[model samples]
Target: MKNNIILSWIEEGVVSIPSFLFSEYKSIGLTDLECMLILQLHAFMEKGNSFPTLEELSNRMTLSLEQCSQTLGSLLTRGYLEILKGHTDQGIYFEKYSLQPLWKKLINHQLLVEKEQTEQQLKLEEGSLFTIFEQEFARPLSPMECETLAMWIDNDHHNPALIKAALQESVMSGKLNFRYIDRILFEWKKNGIQTVDQAKQQGKKFRSHQQKTKVEERKKGGTDTVPFYNWLES
Candidate 1:
């Protein structure tokens, strides 16, 4: 008998609510009561009751029928709920509730929030990149230099880490200047080196070739030497 009762309860089914609605309702300008009312409507609709009466809705909650009607009116006014009217085969008119507006609002709000977070993160990264550039140069950047850096990121679409790698390469080669760093960046792009590891590998290969050339020159009794890997020349 208990198993039969449990099976009957299970047959009654459950209401499906979007998990995000619980967390993000307030962000989309819905109060607790309004959100709860929406949940009740959703439950009723899921049970094949498209338009549950205010009395039926309020019977399951602390609200009175009048309060439920007011809340429904407010939801319609605020574009969170919509009543769709249609006719049946016998030309009978019927009204049903649609939660589409609410779903759309929730999705749009989430997208806007994600966009804001991405912009904030990008701003923080840009600020740190600028500070690192100033420290490396040992001076505050001029307006033109600042513009150039912005151009590298915004227009040229260079990654901050890649730009920093180019700067380091310039410093190591004893050519600590913007023009030299630009040339390094250009050569790196030309060679399809998007990562610092790839840049390091390219430098190692060049140094190995230079070492082989030096050994051959020594055998030929020539004593000329190249001190640094000049990216501009490459």
Candidate 2:
């Protein structure tokens, strides 16, 4: 019966795994042997080897049976692997190894990596902003001015693109001052403008558009109004 099972697995063919498991994620935390053990466990599950033997696993690797046990023990202790009881389709309970802990660790590590990348990108953008401002103003920024520029991004949540647009507007208007650029940003904020393109389109609104309708009304004529009545005249 056992030989039949081994033959069945052989007939079932090779199991596929993501290359990243060994190429990238292995070096992050899992040791070489531990990574191999995980892959073997994965293969076992996929190939209907519900419970793979330590002897088989060790034979596949350079590790001895004792070393395999010790490694698995370490993995369990470190919360890298877990045992779970799950139901099959027929409602029969089966014990299986869970890789949930590994998945959770990988997810957290990726999130941290993404966050670090974003921070690095933001730093690069901030440096670029400093250089652009220096070139625009024809002088190095004062400490106080630099602090204000930092506040625009860090505290006010202004993205580099929006600030750059405002700078461009200042240059176009021949008023290359920080105050004018700040006011432009403030106006864009009030108008709920998210992109430079949106703000530019807003500047092209119809003269007879709703936004200008009130001013047009005033320019044309006033609405009808009753004459003021004196209280004592009645």
- TM-score of each prediction: 0.72, 0.74
Which stretches in model 1 have alpha-carbon errors above 4 Å? 1-5, 88-92, 138-144, 151-162, 165-175, 183-234
Across 120-223, the per-residue lDDT of candidate 2 in tens digits comes to 99889888999999999999999988998999998988878888887876675566877777877777787798887886675445222533555566678955
Which one is best on TM-score? Answer: 2
Error of 2 at 203 (Å): 5.2
Instruction: Please write out the lDDT profile of model 1 over residues 40-74, one tens digit for every residue.
Output: 99999999999999889999999998999999999
How far off is residue 84 in model 1, in Å? Answer: 1.9
lDDT of each: 0.90, 0.77
Query: What TM-score would you give candidate 1 relative to the actual structure?
Result: 0.72
